[model samples]
Target: MKDDCPWFLGYSGGKDSSALLKLVIIALSELTSYHKEITVIYCDTGVENPVITDYVYQTFENLKSECLKLCLPIKYKIAVPKLDDRFFVKVIGRGYPTPTNIFRWCTDKMRINPVKQIIDVHPKATVLLGIRNGESKQRDRTISKHSKSEYYLSQSGSKRNQIFSPIINHSIKDIWSTLKFNNFPKSIDSQKLGELYKDAGSECPVYRELPGKSCGSSRFGCWTCTVVRKDKSISKMIENGYSQLTYLHEFRNWIAEFRDNTEYRCAQRRNGQIGLGPITLEGRKVILDKLLDVELKSGIALLQKEELIRIKELWQSDLKNPNYIEKTAHSRVVKVKTHPKPPI
Candidate 1:
């Protein structure tokens, strides 16, 4: 590795990312402090599971503090989407329909773009990840396309970077076993993972198990993902005793279910393309209402203060659109509480 070339690790807080994190830490620990130009980053979509968000925050603190004690240059960073591009702003403010596989507009905004932007800042560097062959057939195929050279140049029109994966050939068992032999305090809760696996009952999901379906016994993707048919992984956590997250799961499911109801959407898209879109302003208020109620009941804020501020601004802006019809479409309110939020 080049002495000054920084390395960026993509962390998702799932098993694969956790393993990769440990591997990078171990590698950097072996090198002299002068050669340790490594940066580990997590792309936070803002709407991630509260448990996961909390875990990652604390874990980063721990890793940073430990590296400081060792006098190492390993740094931990978090990449977040721009405010207006955040998930809630796009959904409630702009009224984007819940993302489908065909319309996954959130991916680039919430995940990829932020990471790429980080890479672009370093002029040229190495990006590391935990992607492995046995994880999926498609992933394996993609990995095969790259050269076996120690490094592969990843570039864009404006910037160039390198990509490397030390654990490309590691199997599922190998990953777990390696961790067993070289564990640092685990980033995720082992007890919670065990509970999730037990809650999964008969079979366990592996890697990506189709949208809306649970991917594994203890997966940790964004809490707001509507792509999967069932966020079984998070649901399992709730079942196993993380009641605070239940309302989050409910809200996520509701958003997905609510997106397709023609009664709520505008007759045309923002571009007049005659397509499905976000619900009405009144409908959006209903979502906001439930979200607030959930926040009050769970004592965990689902929407950040900044997000609420943005949504309010968007609502006011929407009222000014040439298409705004206050009389018919904007007058509705939550006439009655839909469901009492569960006891905290």
Candidate 2:
């Protein structure tokens, strides 16, 4: 008998991943003669909307029920990053500049790291990611390389990591059509989620420092992303009567303002000498005061408590360093009530 390799299906509560999960479930059911373990893993950043989290949990329950019905041995796991206030950690906690395309340190820390940790344990496994061709040019290049390469680089095949993206060939329309025809798993409210997407009408911001400016008109990301000049996600949420989201929206808006004020950034790099251009002295003071005010008024710790401790320790160290000096706070920038123009 041939050895059965384990399957690690990546679940991201998105439509593509959900569809991929359904297909995998169906395929595994038909292949009942084989004795293989399938583990569905969802890497949580602890920042997803409550609705998304609920959907993830409910989907697992439904999948488990299906597995039992089919008498299959399919297990599931959900992993979340340390409650490290990722956004709050660097910006408010350590006073790092808001993320930009050039400095997208958040994705790896919050999105990729937790999943990579799981993969490390399953050194020899076939990992399935729901990356579709229509997603982006980067994804296209990745898939093309995987198709042509001797080993799948994404799965780290050199370490016996096998990546299988069955839906890479499917189009967005095809995916939705399949879901619509098959009916959304009872776990998720297709109608409500569809409404949310329609209303949100924002793309996930891959770039943070200047979201719309650099990445385009997308906001499906951290509520506190300072990259976009204006946060459409917050605006859409508020418009949809999610009043609680307003605080997050306001906070993000404030953060964007801080990014424009360059002074808060380091004159010299994290090391001693200047790497990039210097952030003006005034900009630095503006960013620090604003960040401190946001912490005080919002009464929300930007990073996880432990991360905050680390950030504060770093701040203290920077204060004492001869190369870097802490400056006094400056006057705050008053937010204009009028809605600003969206990214062109």
Q: What is the lDDT of residue 46 in candidate 1?
A: 81
Determine which window of 10 residues in candidate 1 has minimal summed lDDT. Answer: 201-210
Per-residue lDDT tens digits for candidate 1, residues 1-344, read 45677778777665566677777777766776465377887878787778767777887887777778877677887888888889888887776787876677776677777777777778767777676665556545555655354543322324366566677677767766655667554444445344434433211111112223233223455677787767787877887788998888888889888888766776556665555545777677777788788889889866778888898888777665665432212333323122232111
- Number of clashes recorded per candidate: 8, 15
Candidate 2 residues lying further than 4 Å off, grouped into runs, are 1-3, 61-71, 82-85, 148-160, 199-220, 275-303, 320-323, 327-344
In angstroms, the error of model 1 at 251 is 1.8
Candidate 2: tens digits of C-alpha lDDT, residues 1-344: 14577777777666666777777766666673866788887865644553445556876787778678777777888866655536555554455666766776676676556766776676677777766665666646645655635433344434457677777778878866766666534444455446555544333321111122332133334555555567665577678776655655676676666665533444445465644322333443455456556556655443345654665565444444555533212323322122142101
Q: How much does candidate 2 score in TM-score?
A: 0.73
lDDT at position 17, candidate 2: 69
- The alpha-carbon RMSD values of the candidates against the true structure, listed in the order shown, are 6.5, 8.1
Minimum summed lDDT over a 10-residue window in model 2 is located at 335-344
Candidate 1 C-alpha RMSD relative to the actual structure:
6.5
